[model samples]
Target: MKNRIFILSILASLGFLSSCSDSYLQEDYSDPTLISYDESTIRTNQDLQKFIRGLYSRLGTSSFSGDYFTYQELTGDLGFVSARNSGYFINTNAENHLVVDGGASSGIWSSLYNTISNANLILSYEGKVPDNPNGGVTSKALFAHAKVIRAYNYLALLGLFSPNYGEGDQSLGVPYSTTYNIEAKLPRETVPKVVDNVIADLTSSLADFESDNASAIFTNNNSFNANAIKLLLARTYLYKKDYQKAIQFADQVIDLGGELVGGGTNTGNTTFSTIFTILGENNPEILFQIEYNNIIPSNNNLQAYWGTSGAYKQNFMAKAFWDDFPSTDVRKSNVAWYQNNATTYPDDPKPINVKKYLNGPRDVILLRKTEAFFIKAEAQYHINPATAFTTLKNWVTTHRDQAYSKSLTGTAVLDEILRQKGFEFFLEGMRFTDMKRNNKAIVKVQKANNVPLGEIPVGDRRFIWPIPLSEIQTNPNIKQAPNY
Candidate 1:
């Protein structure tokens, strides 16, 4: 099968060319801007930093910005788009949930690949940056940062598209594009190979950061730095099923000591509301986020999709998920609200609206310390159940449900951790992957106006998304996901 691979032209990366025209092989090209910039365009640290910022800009607008989270939430058991409105039909089913081309889909596959391709281009110029005689550290740091971006993008692709690393592993993996060769039709590597590549990139990048003794190259958690890198390590290890390694890295972050959920607030009933009230680039808990500079002209999709005052509104909580929370659970109070025939879905019987994203132009959190603690808890459960339950109890009791006391042991302990993660992360986009990772059957048995629409069993093919049709048409080596 052939999959379409969109490659940005070299001139376009230099910020000159606008769009490509047909019949490019005529050889009488008259684009002057493309001819001006050469190897010297990115020789210094300033030039490299500017290019890096451009890569970050791509991240801001990509499907992962807020669209990815929205799609994930609706498809998961925690939330569902109303069946009354055919407009949200794509989000209602597994088949059209996310796509590589066109209309209402998340459009993540292409957006991520574009960013990856650009990172590859920037990395190709690593040698061009002059080495500092004092230590050659600045040039090395720049190169390492580029690797971090590449690794981050690749991991995002793997998480959504490819199967889990262990038993759920699909032999096929997304193409690892590490070069700026547009004509290159790279085949999908195996799942292990993809994981290895990400680990290799992060490992090398961490080494470079240590060599320069640079703990942080960027501030405000807006860019990838040493701290963010460690968080990524913890998350990656968790996905890879390396419980011990995941715990080790999570410990590093925990020991470093920062606020739990973005600010130095007590983890009581007020924790969720307080932290979200002031969420921004400088939030202490955020290890990495997509930042918006201005508060007034915010283009963040979260504000529109989840924001209470914003125009668009179709997303609502699954009642079963809401009912799972204790009556006094602060997360339930802070994260969602009962909107009775208010706007959008009038047919919904007091449908729950997510309130976490009410204010925007706020930073879109990609990683936070709260998640680190949860990762540690889950990892510990697999290693030592007693200690894991203790950790889980302490964290949840203090931060989440104040009255929460459940003597969970064995498999129940793991279930509790997953459940806590669902409540904490909520719509920040971890639900689908978490369910899949644990091989949990998605039982959306809630009666939405007395309708039983969702009940996906384990080993169901719909759980895995189809490879975008465009990809299958252009890249001859690409294979669609099994049972797609």
Candidate 2:
């Protein structure tokens, strides 16, 4: 039997508790309904192909324990609300972890491990593929794809669970499980080290998959192709503050001939809707996206971003930076909701509810070309402002000039650059992370109830959300984030 620790690591995000038994991780399923891994029936190529599709199906769930749902749901500038409170939901801008809140907590808690376990399930069965028809040396290709997804899931997990990048390898992090065994539950590695493992997994994944799958196979850009995988690597390294690697990888994505558009960049018949729309898999700007149908299949972030009583409604943008958007910029043309009407006693409605994922159509937030550009610009500026400014100005003007009345250029350009980013991303589950990374502040000008917006206070410990309380309790191996 596999060790209990490893099993929990695999099922940790699946809402499954280990209690004391380790077999849960390695337990062979008797139910034909649940992923059937019978080595005997897997004789034909089609059978092996079926297994691969099962892997894909598992990776593509609404409440997936993976990065897409978690990042959009947790960590960002918003907060989840009391489920009983008129179904009110929003990304509360507080650092207090919400492990006990049953609804919001479960998605953040169970989805990623559900994602991670599926990857391991794929990895565990790959060696046996030769017995199956769909089993070619491509088994290695499938394995790499699964690992890339796993790496993406971990990146999201670390964004919320792990602390700073400087903590290096010694900083506490999540356990490592490749074989899906329960016994091998790895202890907490440091944040930096955890990142190292992510890099290592990604490194292997890239090496194995790139030559084979750079151009996405499906019409919907859901799977992790080479370029998309590269983009994720850049994002991961950027979080780690490994500027050179971040730049290197981001450059690779840019070289693929894609760039961020849509901020007055694209001109023509239709302008971007201020409310939720434009999430389909076909958008040119979308380099990669998690595919979902509004009704049948799940598009997790959609509910959060465009949901009525959903979390997005709760996380409407703060007016603190609203004026930052250029007046002429069509990008500001109501892409989200902010109340212009004021009631008696100075009551104005919430402002920042970005409708990027509304029900009209489409799917998840795409890894846009703009994000890659911003990452490169930020990476450059971190070490040298002049070079960074030049790169940024060029990107902004060449890419964003369509909407803006004037071009931005000056010493104080970071805000301008970030301002566009705010417009480009906003509620895409990135604002909070960007705020933290760029060393920007998260101020509350007035009290929670007070309508007044806050000042620009530096991002502090409160800025880095505490790890959810449940993890600390169950996994004594991990420590609570400081000041929790």
Candidate 3:
């Protein structure tokens, strides 16, 4: 039975259960010949737990957890592909070669949908499984956990594949599904409708937490919990431009504790960079992270792409973006010039690479408590600008820099808040989405010319990634993004 369950996990991870075809949109999990055992295999809550672990592993894959960050940063202005390195993301750095069949588009699209399909299957066994033998993992908790994963994947898909929520209500959102119907032909939901669905899933999950007697047992930094759901709600509301609700949910996260991981002086062993090395094991600031180790190895290429000692050394921080940081800033420790003689050009100066993931097997952080502070600051700016300024000032003083005494009012306050956020989450994959949400243009920094490349104007068709050719070919109801 144990061997059968392990085989089930392996098959699910390889997409055998999600789809027999190339496109995830055509998933057919009900086909009897595909699996040796029926739904009876998942007869216990422990069995459901094992199955859900597969979904978490899928989330940790290169397509979803690893390259997704690289795609976001390279496409944005903060990072650029190095001429002295491998050919990874070269076209993406130049903002060219984004087509329907491109790997960047298809990889993220397929992986997310596959995970969602698995979550739907897990949610189907809500009441059928018996109570966990270990206790504290009720069917209700398991169902809520599945809902959070499903909603998170949908939210990620919406951010990458659809137009920004601030674009317009009628903008197209990717197809969202909640059932395991093999023959279902799902169409794209509008941005507004998708947001509504995501919110409904999260809200329903919160209710499940409230009703579950063993809810606290499941709420941890490694898995979905009430606070993680609240953080997602805050992010969704922030993207939707609903500031009041954003602030409310963000405050709930803040009130729950887990202070930011830096002090006024970053002189000690515990600094802002410690957040990455610790892997959230005992870290209070981490709300949730996708952990990777020897047993369950990480599929992300962040180490190879960003680390100076990486195998590929494919990307580096833009000089212009690096100059924005002050020497006093502790976050500067993560950015260093590539010094290896083998990779560096003797004539050309060394380029700066992010050192956040210098060693392999680093965990991918999905949500942090520090984000709540930023969200509250930004959301407060919409409601009360002066309060927002104070909020930003206090956070910077307490955590980032004690000498950070910039007195600004009006929109400048909002600008500084975003700038700090950009610094805080440089390689963690928040910059591109934040830029899109604010309708900001991408200003590429040209290395040879030392001048800014022409900005990719707001609302450019390229800003929204193309729907993969596979999905377009298989699903007639789904339409491609405009102009792609």
Top lDDT hit: 3
lDDT of 1 by residue, 383-475 (tens): 888889999898877766678888988988888888888867877878877887778887753324444456667887656666777777778
Give a tens-digit lDDT track for model 3, residues 225-285.
6777898999999988899999999999989875664543443323455666634344677
Ranking by lDDT: 3, 1, 2
lDDT of 3 at 118: 72
Worst 10 residues of 1 by lDDT: 1-10
Each prediction's Cα lDDT score? 0.66, 0.54, 0.71
Residue lDDT tens for model 2, 191-230: 7766888899889888877654422324456556667778
Runs in model 2 deviating more than 4 A are 1-48, 62-91, 94-106, 131-137, 167-169, 183-185, 214-217, 258-260, 263-280, 294-301, 304-314, 333-353, 402-413, 444-470
Q: What is the lDDT of residue 168 in candidate 3?
A: 51
Off by over 4 Å in 3: 1-37, 169-171, 210-220, 263-271, 278-280, 333-350, 446-454
Instruction: Estimate the lDDT of model 3.
Output: 0.71
TM-score of each: 0.83, 0.75, 0.86
Backbone clashes, candidate 3:
0
